[model samples]
Target: MNRKKEILEKLAFIKSHKELVSFGVKEQEVSHNPCLSEAEIAAFERKHSITLPDDYRFFISEIGNGGFGPGHGLLPLNKAIVDFKLRDKPNISLNKEFPYQDDWNEEWIASFDWDEEYPDTEIVDAYISTAHIAGCLQISHFGHGCTFLLVVNGNEKGHIWFDGRADYSGLIPKMKDGHRISFIEWYVTFLDMEIENINKSLTNSTTD
Candidate 1:
């Protein structure tokens, strides 16, 4: 199928399935400050303006909380690191399941290159699986809207979905075409916090 047509179908499916997952956002918490506003997001009428897919928004908000880690228990964002490392290893089977399974075959993996081009620095990481050829995962923060933009690689721009809030500043990197890069910095941030909490718990257990 063509890129435009595929995106349209995905959008239609997502719009219809908004209720599949609970967004966890209290209707009363819609406050606005710097990054993004409900009004601004609502004003975005074109799909090219953002980097999120209609259905993928669930992964950031309702599916995995704001940041993609272990919120849903379905697919962990940490898995991306493993996938990237094993991209050229062997026996890689790209399955179309949640988190998208992979075995690391050179032929299948080498077909895709990570650093072939200077991607947007703002985008901390990007991912692609056999599930969707045109779609790609992007991590980036927009002003106060520290969200995820799961784009369609190089086709139509993409859509923007919330990934919670963080206090950050300065210019974030975007694609050469002027699109923002996905930010995967939170994955590491969350990993550190998880380790700290675990260590603290272990210490407390020993003392107790």
Candidate 2:
């Protein structure tokens, strides 16, 4: 029962069932920008040398502070409830539209395939908005965890994932002059906090 309380009880069951499945995060209005200052995240981990754990620097300084929005701009992919039972697991694919290059773009690692993969998929959460301002980030690093997330909004750019799994004609793998980026309709209205300290520590669990 460690691993940071199992990733905070799977983000409190994704923030409590996230309104029975949508995109979770209904009313979260707290602003005052200019965040990311722990000496600017330790100088962005000493100029990208690495070592930014502690649960991804407390999940980007506390569960995505000053950002995570969909008030109007874009970048929102809330589809949980186990994503409709892994929607026809030919690997699975739903949210479409992608291309926005830039962000460790070695051709987006050819959408992952570095020699037959499968270590819990890959990408673990990403969001990039174009115009105005809107940002969300996640990437739980796996099989060589270094992680990635690039948020920009003026020229528009968005990528969202939290563990990869795109195959069934999801058509992932683009970078021939990348600049696609789309999916920004709107969702994620989850709000159901306080779970009695995670159901009283999972009902006094004894390795069920």
Candidate 3:
């Protein structure tokens, strides 16, 4: 199937699943407010000087904007921008190139003295700046500040990453078979996992 058709089919499958519905998956208006049209997307891209990844671009344009996706839900483009601006430091520009070639060092984290007056805010700010992807957006939230990010620019463009800065301290690629997965792959995997969980739950319930 084509990309558009594949995305719509997957979304429809999610919506139709009874287990998914019980888990709070619901469809929302794609042709209304909060959802972007091709014109709006073009304008946003021009303003930001960056283009969204193909899979993600298709999603917001063809599927839905903010109301129905992985984790809590996909964030609307505008909302994602607003949130990023609020959290980002003034010196760091979203359009600037992301610096790191790999995930932040885990060993370096052990050197920090938790007892001292360490500048967690400043440290995290630096990390975010270095890891920032020019046109990337937060596509899903896993609660407590963890999010799935779609890379829209730079070397890792078109890949989805797990932003565990809130809990684990840095961004890491969502890998499968030692390769980073794209937005569509990640979304499909998520849906499959949810479906599996639902089936297991039903089986357990019936046994009891």
Candidate 4:
């Protein structure tokens, strides 16, 4: 389904209403970056050895490369890759199957529960190298040590996940109504909420 028409309409409304405090709008500070062409997107996919999820692929090619969405704003597609390498090991690559179906930090912690008096620094070092982020592309920094990732391969492809491991919350899927939220769903929710906030702000001002 084509969302370009609908998404642009919301973006236009948000951009035109400068007086409103739309979510992430001030952080973006301007309209989003220019849209990338289909060829540009294809080239990126080729280089990365992974096909982006349909909605996200469409967004970069049709809406904008990146800028303004959830949290501190979406990042440019080129900057979205996770470093999946652990030490001298090669990257696991984005096309590899995403390793988890649910929260994974607990598993990670269990893997290296060293003695408090004699911590295994090498094991801890490996954990910090981002092995858990394999097969995903980062989309947003959710602030306060949290990140948002888009699963790039395997069964979870196309769904957004919350990388909350920094806060010891684990890698959790973004869910709504018991289902994982897709890229489009996540984005449209942001647009809807921002529009609602703008309308409320305008209404409150008029009544005053």
Name every residue pair that clashes in candidate 4.
none
Instruction: Write model 3 residue lDDT over 1-208, tens digit each, in one string.
Output: 7866765665555555554343444343212235579998888788877888887777778766766667676777776654343345332234654444588645656677767755567765665553454445776777787777777767888888877766646777789888889988887676666567666766888899
Provide the overall lDDT of each model, using Cα atoms, as 2-decimal numbers.
Answer: 0.32, 0.32, 0.66, 0.77
Please tell me which model should have the higher lDDT, number 3 or number 4.
4
Report the lDDT tens digits of candidate 2 across residue range 1-208.
Answer: 5644554455457455343323223443222233355776776445433334344355345444334333211211121101222323121121222233333222345576758963343332221111101232322121222212222122323333222222221222122234343222111211122234445455656456
Question: Weakest 10 consecutive residues, lDDT, candidate 3?
Answer: 24-33
**CA RMSD for every model?**
17.9, 16.2, 3.9, 3.8
Q: Which candidate number maximizes lDDT?
A: 4
The TM-score of candidate 1 is 0.24
Steric clashes per prediction: 17, 21, 0, 0
Per-residue lDDT value at 92 in model 3? 22
CA-RMSD of model 4: 3.8
Q: Which ten residues in a row have the lowest lDDT in candidate 1?
A: 25-34
The alpha-carbon deviation from the true structure for residue 94 of candidate 1, after best TM-score superposition, in angstroms, is: 21
